[model samples]
Target: MTGWDISPAGVQSVVSNVRDAADAMNSGITLYGKSVEGAMTSAGTLSFGTDGVGGDAAGLVALALAKFVEGTERDMAFLPLRASNSANGAVEATNAYISGSLEQAWNAQRQATRAPDVTAFLEAARKKAGEGR
Candidate 1:
């Protein structure tokens, strides 16, 4: 039999660290968003040249920049949510362990390992029914 050991303090420390990282990442994201907003505002009136070709090139550049910003925002939006979920899961699991519920659940699963084989039981029943028929 294998033994399991868990430390509540260790789990708490991990949770704290994850939360701190999430906070830092969120702050960085907010700052980046502000910077991008400022840059976009400044670029709004930018002109490449009075010629049609230059105007088209400038429009293409602006469109590409906008797409890049949108993609980056979409990709980074979930970082904080994922971190929060991870920390919350660790806390919940640690609480279950401290309450002895985790052990009880493991024991229950171990006991259930001796469950009857349903396929064999079904085959036996089928054979008996066929014999009677």
Candidate 2:
């Protein structure tokens, strides 16, 4: 078995690291949300009409702006949702890792404290009891 630094301090450090990563993830989420908000605001501010010279060029510019706004709005709407999903996934994975590590440490400690021949001893005791019956 690989050596493990399965002390209380070690576990606490791991948990703290996970929390730090989560804090970073939260900050990233906030930033992504702000970006989405900015994109939406920009899309809202886009003018879809003539730009002084009302001609084919103006129409093309307007069309391009409309398309840009549509794409920006759609992308912005989904950006936060995707970032939220990614953050949630990170938290879930972290929780799972912590839980599994702690559980394995606990199990290892329990095993270390148990006699290697405990099962054999129990079987012998059961056989003796059966013989007495």
Candidate 3:
């Protein structure tokens, strides 16, 4: 089922990415020969809002990232690796294809959204599950 079960880090990453991209796009106004004043007048301060360049870019970027998360999540979510790949001696290629997709998602999210501190959290969680200290 669908849900809004996103971590705070995820939300932050997404917002931060969108903000940064908006800044980059706004900066590009100079390349097209648009003066700061002209660009502002044309593009306006919408990039920082929810209905401007920032918003549109964020939506597009997020949708693509979600697909990445799904691909990796689903692939890893399954049991064993055989079911996910062919026996053409391409295990590495298969794993990479899956992981690379995740990497791309991660990159995009960093650009358009936030990501969780999964490594730290998981490491700590594993430690907790180990023999009592």
Candidate 2 lDDT over residue span 1-133, tens digit each: 2443434455556556656665676577568657655655454333344785433333444455657755654444444343443444444444444566645544544443433343454467569989998
Question: Which regions of candidate 3 deviate over 4 angstroms?
Answer: 34-133
Model 2 has an lDDT value of 0.50
* Per-model C-alpha RMSD: 18.6, 22.3, 21.5
Candidate 1, clashing residue pairs?
A: none
**Candidate 1 positional error at 29, Å:** 0.5
The local lDDT score (0 to 100) that residue 10 gets in candidate 3 is 49
Instruction: Give candidate 3's whole-model lDDT.
Output: 0.40
lDDT tens digits by residue: candidate 3, 1-133: 1221334454445545555654554455334324433443444222355655455233444445556554554233221222222121123323333454544433443332233344555467569879575
By TM-score, rank the candidates, best first.
1, 2, 3
In candidate 1, what are the lDDT values of residues 29-83, reduced to their tens digit? 8898787666665565445667845552334445667788867754566567667
Model 2: CA > 4 A from native? 1-5, 45-133
Model 1: lDDT equals: 0.67
Task: Evaluate residue 45 in candidate 2 and report its C-alpha lDDT on the 0 to 100 scale.
Answer: 35
Question: Model 3: which ten-residue window has the lowest total lDDT?
Answer: 79-88
